[model samples]
Target: MTETNDTANLIQEAEYFYQKIFAAPVPRPILEKYIAANRKKMPRPDERIRNLVLKKADIEAVEMAWRFKSPRNVLTKKIHILIYLAETTPENFSLFFNTKNKRFSSFIVLAGHFVRSMGKFLKGKFLLKRYNLV
Candidate 1:
């Protein structure tokens, strides 16, 4: 069916976008500074993860939180976008909020990322360059 195909395409697009954000490197110094300032808020609270992050792991501490932590894994960079949409978008009204299903939650998160990233792109922000995602 056309609807099924559309959903599949959207999921594929979301996966691509997620991979781009995941693989994008954060500057070591910048990430370190963020960790230093925000360690109290970080999950896991493991000194080993902390040390690995300080040693410049491929992913930032925030990314590590997603890969290693639960419930918190549902939290992504575009959570603000999700909140905004839940508050404002009529089409998505009563949807995508407080979702417990990981798959649906991931879909909402990716949709949020897509919306925010598209907005930035429209504003002439070179996202890949700005985030060093390239």
Candidate 2:
């Protein structure tokens, strides 16, 4: 039983490391847009669009996380998240585009790509410096 638990932890740790190597934590609301879309029991018309409905859906349950949580998500929003997975090294991409003041108006919504990437970058840099790795 202990070994089984250890194996589970190892798997989770590997995934966590993979995610760090990929990008950052996704926001809660963005993940829900996906779950509500997939689950057969559709939220009510009014409940569907409410941010709170999406927020309550567990963010970590978003599948293929390394795909959706990486720099690739920022590039194409993950229609091809896996196609770019093996190449997701930070040196090969950037979330900090030169669009400091950029803005767009759209009726559509995108998932957690942005916040996840940015948060990952910031956290990685902080951890590196904190440990004198930099």
Candidate 3:
């Protein structure tokens, strides 16, 4: 029984680590947009064109429009999010980009985990002292 429990715990830990390596956390505001779109049943592509013909399109000045969310959604939202984050917060672009590339992203996440574990052992001191970043 104890061995079974240990194996289950290990499997859960591995699953969590896998998600941490591949997927990045979606922030609240962007998530809200998807939720709202889902709730409102936003107009379909054809309807959007009709609205344009009548000169009543939402955000007429903008080219790309928002989309409704569904269970089988594509990577469009993910790319949009990455682009938005990269533009707004250029410093963290590498982290955003890594989430797109499997190999590089895995390395970045593992390095982050290693640094965090080391920080705890070093009494919350600098994770990388050689950088001299206070």
lDDT of each: 0.38, 0.35, 0.36
Highest TM-score against the true fold, candidate = 2
Question: Tens digits of per-residue lDDT for model 1 on 1-134?
Answer: 35454334333323333334434343334333333323334322333333322343323233433433332432233332223423454544435455455787789989997886555444322322333322
Model 2 error, position 131 (Å): 1.5
The numbered model that scores best in lDDT is 1
Model 3: per-residue Cα lDDT over 1-134, one tens digit each: 35454334333322332233335454444444433442244222232222332342222111211222132222233334334533455555565455454887788978997876554435323321322212
Pairing residues by index, what is the TM-score of model 1? 0.21
Ranking by TM-score: 2, 1, 3
Candidate 2 vs candidate 3, TM-score winner: 2
- lDDT of prediction 2: 0.35
In candidate 3, stretches whose alpha carbon ends up further than 4 angstroms from where it belongs are 24-134
lDDT of 2 by residue, 1-134 (tens): 35454334333333343354346443233333333332223222222112212233222322233333453422123223322433343444444233354344221223365666556555544543443322
- lDDT-wise, the better of 1 and 2 is 1
What lDDT is obtained when candidate 3 is compared to the true structure? 0.36
Model 3: weakest 10-residue lDDT segment is 57-66
Model 2 spans with C-alpha error above 4 angstroms:
1-110
